[model samples]
Target: MASSSFHAPTLVSILVLLLGNSRAQLTPDFYEDSCPDLLNIVQAQVEIAVQNEKRMGASLLRLFFHDCFVNGCDGSILLDDTPTLIGEKNAAPNANSVRGFEVIDVIKAAVEEACPGVVSCADILAITAKDSVVQLGGPDWEVKLGRRDAMTASQAAANSSIPPPTSNLDQLISKYAAQGLSAQDMVALSGAHTIGQARCTTFRNHIYQETNIDSFFANTRKPNCPGTPGQGDNNLAPLDIQTPTLFDNSYFVNLVAMKGLLHSDQELFNGGSTDAIVQNYSQNPDAFIQDFITAMIKMGDINPLTGSDGEIRTNCRLVN
Candidate 1:
């Protein structure tokens, strides 16, 4: 890791410089003049949300990931369905799965108060994601900002673009690669599961039908998630069996032991190209943290609406 000497701040600064001509010319100091207190405002609201529910940290992070994956790092996922506008909220991958929009709304209101209409909900989400990770004991990074909100969100794109829990190794790689992320980035981002919970509907088949899982791990989860389809499908289970509330490399460790809570997770360590990446992350926390931050910044660059392309929405759920 030649880039090990570079800190997250410096890495982000370089990215800002490199992307100056692209649509994602987002800067770490994007709000330095207009909304100097933007970071603090978002962080404070996120701290409050996470205090109420520790799971909110992971939910916020997942919201950012889902938002970025759909079209870009725009605030499309935060949009509410209107009579004419169909947002991504009801997308198959989102619907009842993606949580923390209410938390984002709270943060957006606070941000609007501090900075008025200068900030974008998309940028609020980016900042909140960093704060959420820090709240959950994960490494922090400088967040790139200056993205605009997408007036139109595609439910179809959300359904097709965001990777599903049942995805296999090849599907995972292809899905991420479609978004310009490398296989390494895919495995690194998957490490976020260290903190969140998955629905029984998402993992029922993995525990009951999968042979690669640990017997003990499967049994522990079985009592909670009924074997029959649609039964107890909404029961909650931690993605990381060991540390469900902490952000750490425990997810990769679980995959190595065949205790991954989802089929998509086990696919990473199932003797594929990503197996070595998973092993490296499990053994090297520093490496994992660095890669996760880098991948996050990279993912934030996807198809962003910058400059005169998109408007700064006063309300995240409704376009101005």
Candidate 2:
């Protein structure tokens, strides 16, 4: 019987065959194709969408948060048959769908309609994240493409890896670092919370406990959190400071006043290990933007398959 697996030539062999030098390694362009170019085209469309409706920028940011937070940008959450798929909502029953998936779906559908089976959903995610930051008035970061889809989705892994809305500064730092992001990256990425909303459940612990939380903010949140657990998450928790819907560095400004709603946000200003980085970002908007870009680049580089570990998936939904 014949074997049924498909295998591309090894990188070493390919280099030797193509250039007579096995020592030569692949560059980012080696994997470039219609998929990444098509991603650029879709990014343009998202820009237009954000331009028309500013809320779309927050939606895009939410998408990045949900998609990556769930499964490290594997595109598994986008699957119609995901185990945790929440009807048409695209999130866990009480969670939001991160909104931008639909926008990305539109782009994917257009790509498929124009040229069937060309782009990968993983690439779509990477592109959308980079573009969404730009849409939100952040720096435009460069993304290296060719991320293949994962064969499985992990609700456990998602829950395990993602920093909860109530995470302290140290916890947040460790989690991002596991994904190959730095402490600076953690602060910059946390800036994303500046425009998102969390449910009552996500931050309820911080409010009701009265021990880990500041008294004033806890008192304010008590009515919404009910002083109990498992009671809320559907409640809205916006990430932005000035415009809850718009993207700006006001999140940093909010930090200066101790107005951060999420524990993760407050922890940054809690005089802990990461406070200096937070203060630095808060004091300088330009530095925040610069670090945000660098952090995004670092975040995108996390544990991705390259050279040989994974395949270029035809359908963004599953691994080949």
- The TM-score leader among the candidates is 1
lDDT of 2 at 261: 71
lDDT of 2: 0.64
Candidate 2's C-alpha runs over 4 A off are 1-40, 48-53, 65-72, 82-97, 205-233, 307-320
lDDT of 2 by residue, 235-278 (tens): 65555536775556788877766767777778887778877877
Compose the digit string of candidate 1's lDDT tens values, residues 1-320.
55675677788888877766765578899889999988888888999999999999999999999999988988999999999999999999998899998888888888888888899999888988989999999998998888988889999999999999999999999999999999999999999999989999999999999899999999999999999988898999999989999999999999999999999999999988898999999999889999999999999989888887778998888988
Deviation from native of the Cα of residue 239 in model 1, angstroms: 0.3
Give the root-mean-square deviation of each candidate in angstroms.
Answer: 8.5, 6.4
Per-residue error for 276 in candidate 1, Å, reads 0.6
lDDT of each: 0.91, 0.64
- Candidate 2, residue 21: CA error in Å? 13
TM-score of each: 0.93, 0.76
Best by lDDT: 1
